[model samples]
Target: MIATNEKLLLDALPQPVISIGSNRHVTYANFAAQEFFGSSLNVLRRQHIVDVLPFGSPVISLVERCLDNSLSFNEYGIDLTPPTQIGGTNNGRMVDLHVTPTEHEEGNRQALIVVQPRSIANHIDRQLTHRGAARSVSAMSAMLAHEIKNPLSGIKGAAQLLEGDAGPDGVELTRLICSETERITGLVDQFEQFTETHADINSPVNVHAVLE
Candidate 1:
């Protein structure tokens, strides 16, 4: 029977870990490993290291090397695909493997392997980068809207004031100025909406209409 303290410690770990005997058979698999492999301890203990891992995987070679050399090895960004599934679900994952060899009670070498998946890590990195870029764009758009739109409002008001006193040609010129200013301000409003973080759900735009 495993000591309470030892079992508790192993189960408390966040990452999956397994120990391989000299025969490359699994001697011990932690709670995380059972969850990762989708198997119980009894089931996992009956299987060999090769059974859980994909056939002809480099990790097997690394395990052998570690056991033979009595040294530790770390491999990063290893793409792993399990050979079999416990409940008809299996997906490939990127992981970092750490192998450490230790002496057993009978003087044989047992290798410990830690499996750390990188999918969650990669996702968090992408999310952070995306949010950072969004914030930067939003700040730039807000600054432009404040600086340009304020002066643009004054120009639009002056053009409207000139429209009544101007002659036909001057009236046309003022009208042109007012129309152009309105168009520019409309563009600035769109930019402001684009920069808003909590924007309303936008309707799908037609690519053909936009292009035309």
Candidate 2:
């Protein structure tokens, strides 16, 4: 926990604030910091900074640099996406990072980090990507639907004609062909759903239920 006055000040700021120990473990995380990392303060406190940041993140290096030289650094457009995934409906956030050396009671190097979230940039990027994918899906669905349905119509008509002229067993086979073509046509129709629009929101989620 942070000291009373310091905690109040940090929590009041819109940007995330974190206090990291010499060992790279979190000492304190303000309210916004929890939301920034997609984690709780308790989880952040237990884990090393490297555990939360993406692999090869520049932020990690900056933290180390600040600790080693007792210097302050201000960086822009830093990506804070999780290692497992990057940028399509992202589970992570982006920010402008600020790191500075801080004093510790044990005379060890520590760091104070501030995160200025740039989530709007990610939102615009995600929307553009979604639109591009939707267009591609729509175009492919139209082309394949046009090409296959034309052939299917001919096949079904041919099958119907054969059913009239053939023996009982042959008629059953023709009917089966007609049924299969209809089923395939139905499958192709489903592709159109991808082009439909939907709302994008950060709805409240049941975390415990998901874990269970």
Candidate 3:
């Protein structure tokens, strides 16, 4: 009864977690794990790691390494698609895999595999990339704001002046030109603001923190 309760507790965790035996068969899969792989506990337990995971998955290699070394291992941002399709879509999550060895019996080792998905990790990567790209365009934004904006504004003013004397079609074209120039100028102004705030933030963190 206590063991069943313990298993239930582990299953309550949000991240997918599984245990792999030395023989490459899966020993246990938590609820989240079952959901991630789109399988039930009975099916998962009967399957080998390779059978569950897609072909050429790095996780297969990582699990093998952990068993061979009898050590804990972790890998980040891995694509772990399962072989079975769920609703015609891949039943896999991009995850960080952590494997720690356990000795259920003397000289017989098993490992706990923790699967943490990388959706949040990918978001951070994109945020950092956005900031870097924003920084890269700082000089260009400054140049455009000065060299281009003033001239463009002058052109817009000229168009507005001509609009009064223009035919109906000519007036519409001039208005479009003015609107486009204003839109471009607004974009350049936004790029300039991004440069001023480089978004450099510092705090205590861990790889798992990014997951949160």
Candidate 4:
């Protein structure tokens, strides 16, 4: 009765779960397992687990180790082929699988396998690439601002001093100097806005909408 209840509980898990017998036959597969492998549970029942999974897959080797030593095996990077009709772009995806020995009423050696897809590492990699590009652009803008700002300020100040000494002779040149300085200052202000706008803001936002 306990073994039967265990089987029911195993089948109830949301993640893909399977039970393999000593003969390496798939004794049980949950609904999620059927969907993930793109086959019905009835079709997989009594079939060898290796028949569905590639022979060279890490998951296959892990299951073999668990059955051989009667010990549990936990591994990441198990690659399994999705059925062609499922529209999977990649040949396979990375997953974490755990296998543990379980005792049955019939005294047959069996193992329980639980599977979870790996996603967090890929997400982190994408975010890091985006931030690296943003940082490079910010650094270049800052360098340009620093290189041009000081020389423009000196030219404007010298023009003002010359105007004070030249009476009416250099009024037009002084006015031109002030206008050019203001134009350069406006450009510098625009660059400053870019650096300021991206300053470590932490606000909750719908990421999907932001991406769109």
TM-scores of the models, in the order given: 0.53, 0.55, 0.53, 0.52
- lDDT for predicted candidate 4 compared with the true structure: 0.76
Candidate 3 regions exceeding 4 Å error are 1-5, 86-88, 120-212
Off by over 4 Å in 1: 1-5, 86-89, 121-212
Per-residue CA lDDT of model 4 for 142-199, tens digit only, reads 7788778888999989898888877675888897888989898888977766863435
Give the alpha carbon lDDT tens digit for every residue of 1-212 in model 3.
11477588888899898888889999888999999888998998899988988788887887888888988888887767787763355543567789888775356777788888878668578569877887768856666667878888998999999999999999999999999999988886766665653355688889897898
Per-residue accuracy of model 2 over 54-124 as CA lDDT, tens digit each: 88889898898888889999998777875544655665466788999887566877789998877787668
Candidate 4 residue 68 Cα shift, in angstroms, is 2.1
* Local distance difference test scores for all models: 0.83, 0.81, 0.80, 0.76
When sorted by lDDT, best at the front, the candidate numbers are 1, 2, 3, 4
> What is the C-alpha lDDT profile of model 1 across 165-208, one tens digit per residue?
99999999998998998899889888788786536777999999
Q: Which sequence of candidate numbers ranks them by TM-score, best first?
A: 2, 1, 3, 4
Task: Give the deviation of candidate 4 from the true structure as CA RMSD.
Answer: 12.4
Q: After superposition, how far is residue 83 of candidate 1 from its true place, in Å?
A: 0.9
